[model samples]
Structure formats: C-alpha cells, structure tokens
Target: MREPLFLIGNVNVDLVMGPQEPWPQPGTEVIVPESEFRVGGAAGNTALALDVLGVDYRLIASRGDDMLGRWLAEPFGARAEAWTVAEGATTVSVGIGHPDGERTFFTTTGHLHSFKLSDVLSQLEEAGDGRVALLVGPFVIPALLADYDELIAILRRRGYRVALDTGWPDGGWTAQVRTRVAAWVGHCQHVLVNDIEARGMTGADTVEAAAAIIRPLMPDGASLVIKCGPDGALAWRGNEHVAVPAPKVDVVDTIGAGDTFSAGYFASLVESSDLARAVTNGVTVASLAVSTRPRRYR
Candidate 1:
C-alpha cells in the first residue's frame, strides 16, 4: 500500500464574498449578493480535496488558540495535527470574487508564520517510510522560507517523494526571490506552479517556454506542471511535454481551484505513475472546482 500523503503548510478561514459586477471603489461600500465562511488556505484546500477523493492524508499546520481555530479544527478531527498558538488570532482571508471569475484577497498571516522546521521534521519522523511529503505555500510562510533548503534535504534523505508548490510571493516576484525559488525547484521531485508564477520564475512569456526553463532545474527524473487557468495545464518531464485541455464551464469562484488541482494531480500520479493521466485528472478536477460554489470540494 502507498503511504499516506503528508500535506504541510498554511491553514486559515476564508470569508468569501462576491459575484459583484464591478469592483467596489476605494473608500466606498458595496454589498455582494452572496457570502460564505469556509476552511481554506492552500494546505487546507488540498487536504479537503484529498478527503473528497477518499485518500488518506495528514495535514500539518499551525492555528491560533481562538474560536476560528476551533471551528477550523472541528472538521479535520484526527487528520489534522495543528499546533495551537496563543500569540494571535487564527489566520483569516477575505476573498472578493468578481463576476468575471477574477479574485482578490485580503489576508492576515496569523499563525501560519509560526510553523517551525523542527515541528515538520518531527512529523516526518512520525510519518515513517515511503510517504509523500507535499510542502505547500512555501513563500507564504516565512518560517518555511527560512529553513526550506534544510527541510528539503531532510525529506529527500528520508526517502520521501517531495512535491512543492511555492504559491505566490507576497510582494510580486523579484530577481532575488526568483533565484531562491529556482533553487528550491532543484530539490523537489514534483514542482507545481501557476502560469504567472512559471513565467515570473523562468522569465518566459509562454507556458511552454516557462516549462522548458523549469524542467532542467528540477532533479533528474522530476516533473514540472504549470496550470493555465482557463486554457488547462501542461506537464514537462525531461524531453517530454504533454498538454491537457480544460473543460469549458461556467466558473463560480476560483479561490482554491489551483490547490484542488494540485491534490488531484498528485493523487493520480501517486496512484498510477502516469504523467499524462495525472494532468488530465488535475484539469478535470479544477474544472469541476471552479464550476461550483466556493469551499465545496466535490
């Protein structure tokens, strides 16, 4: 049997509001037709997706000792091993989704920045052999960013199949951040990035060009997958490149679509070891995700 997946990263509560026609102006108020409160963050969304797929996975993250934290933990039960911190309130993200499917976020970093490498290492030791360790939201967590190199080395040394999703850096991409991201990609067995992230990280104008540039940076035999929002996704492994087209559907809210795609892609890859099928699974899942209401994994 394949070992359980270990998903490590940010955990937060998402307050999604929208379907508004035009964005509200600065210093003005506009009410949306709909709003929802749900569990989110890249790690949380991925874990929820895995659950919907009936896959066994463990979520490792930090949460604040507050009502929101308790609310978030209630759903995960035993699958989540979250460290509770008393220093601040749990992370909360206010997501504004426009009618055109575009989204923006106002977030509080909260306890996400408090996750320590030592905590992660201890979890890995407990996870034992052959498990897949997915490090999500690397750049979002300052603690993870500080000890990323050491953490990757340790996971690789312990025989874990490491997958990384850097997410988007807080301050748009820069030369220094790009170089650091490239270095992190070198150590991962599977690298996941959105089209914008791929272009920024590789200085390539197109998904194909970006994938080509990132392919060589990954370790030998590794794969890089770039998700193109409406166009679909592309996977690159060595000299091979495969493009999977997404199904056209009415998009509701795209808040956690990418993270859901990551869950589907990784789950398929782990189950079948087929790159082409994995990309198909990812696109299919993401298509379904975006067609539904925010926070509904299935």
Candidate 2:
C-alpha cells in the first residue's frame, strides 16, 4: 500500500491585487483591475492541490490565532492541524501583479518563524508508519531550519520517506546556506527545485549542470526534479534522466503553480513510483493551475 503524505510548512493568507494602471506614488491609490484573498504558502498550496486530486494527506503548520488562519484552515477541515499562536499575527503575503503576468510579494513572517521541530515531531509520531513527509519552506521557519539536520535524522529513523522543497532562501544562496541545504537534500528521498534554485545551490550556470551537481548528493534511488517554467521539467534518478515538456496553456496567474507541480509529482510518485509518469503528471497539473484562478475554500 502507498504511504499517506504529510505536508509540513508555513501557511498564510495571500492578498493578491493586480493590473494597476500605474505604480501608486506616496499615499495615492492606483486600482485598475482585480483582487482576491486566498490561501498561500508552499505547503498550503500543495496540500490543497492534493485535495483536488483526491489524495489522502495531512497538513501540519503554524498560523496566528486570527480570522485569516481560520479562513485558511476552513478548506482543509479535519485534514489541517495548524498550531495557532496568540502572540503574533498570521503570516500574510501581499502580492502586487503587473499587466505582463509578473508579480512581487511583500510578506510578513509572523507565526511561521516560530514553528518548531518539537511541534513537527509530535505530529509525525501520530502519523503512524509508512508515511511520506513533504517538508516545504524551511527558509520561512527559522526554528525548524535551525534544527533541520536532527529532524531529518529522526524522520529517517522512523522510516518516513522524506521529500523537501526549500523554496528560496532570502539572502540568495550563500556558501553556508548551500552547505546546509545540501545536507538536507542528502537526507531526502526526493527533492523539488526550480531552475534558479538549482543554479544558485550548485553554482552552475545551466540546469543540466546544476542537476548533475545535486544528483550525487541525493540518496541512491532517490529522485531530483528541476522545474523549468514554460520549458518543462527534468527528473534525475541514479544514472537515468527524463525530461518532460510542460503543456502550453493560457496562463492567468502562476502564484502557486510550482507548489501545484510538487503536489502532482509527489502524489503520482506515491501512487505509481514511476519518475517519468510523475514528472508528466506534475507538468500537466501545473499547466492547469496556472490557467485558472487560485483555489478557494470549499
């Protein structure tokens, strides 16, 4: 039987606004388009995508004890276990989108920075055996990031299949950060990184070179997926490599597309254990996600 997936990461409320006529100068307001509030964060998006695909999974994350947190959890219902903190606000990301599909985000870390390893282990212990853990956005959780090595060791000892999506460190990939990230990748059974993240981590100019550098660090029989937006994705397992092209679509908003891809890829791998098919499914799902508006609570 396939193991159930457990997503561990940050959860936040996203206020996305877009297509303004011009940049707001000083106190003036510029509103030329649309706006919406939705759940945001790698783990939140991935868990929701898995829900849409009818995959059995659980979400373990931290949120502020506020209305936004409650709103965010409403979609997952019983499947979400969000540790609410009273001292701070829920993480919120305000995204400003341009007419050409580009967007910039202003984020407040809030409760996410306090998500600790102890909280994660408690959830994992209750998850039982034969489960896959997808740890997303370590960068956003400083407490968890500091204890990542020990956390991965504990998870491995408990027989969980570990996967990671490091999202992108704020200060770019410095030497120290790269070392730590490489160590985390070594402990994971699967890793998902975008083209820029791959290049930054490996100090390699091309995706192929970057993938080559990281592949050796991955555990034997594990897979590394490099997501290339528009172009497609590349999957590497041991000595074999497969490249799958993304389906072209009329893209609306790509806010959570990569997270959607991670969900599709890992869910398929849990079901089929075929890397090629998993990559194909990931691309297909990402295409669909980018073409539509962000998913809302059901």
Best by TM-score: 2
TM-score of 1: 0.94
Q: Taking the tens digit of each residue's C-alpha lDDT, what string does model 2 give over 146-178?
A: 898998888888888888988899798999999
CA-lDDT, candidates in order: 0.82, 0.83
Q: For model 1, what is the error of residue 102's alpha carbon versus the real structure, in angstroms, after optimal superposition? A: 1.1
After superposition, the stretches of candidate 2 with alpha carbons farther than 4 Å from their true spots are 81-86, 126-128, 294-298
Query: Candidate 2, overall lDDT?
Result: 0.83
* lDDT tens per residue, model 1, 36-149: 899999999888888887777878787787889888888898755545453678889998887788878898878787777876765556434767788898877887779988
For model 2, name the residue pairs that clash. none
For model 1, the superposed segments whose C-alpha errors exceed 4 Å read 25-28, 82-86, 126-128, 294-298
What is candidate 2's CA lDDT for residue 115?
Answer: 83
> Which 10 residues in a row give candidate 1 its minimum summed lDDT?
78-87
What is the TM-score of each predicted model, taking all chains together? 0.94, 0.94
Q: Which pairs, if any, clash in model 1?
A: none
Reference-based lDDT, residue 7, model 2: 85
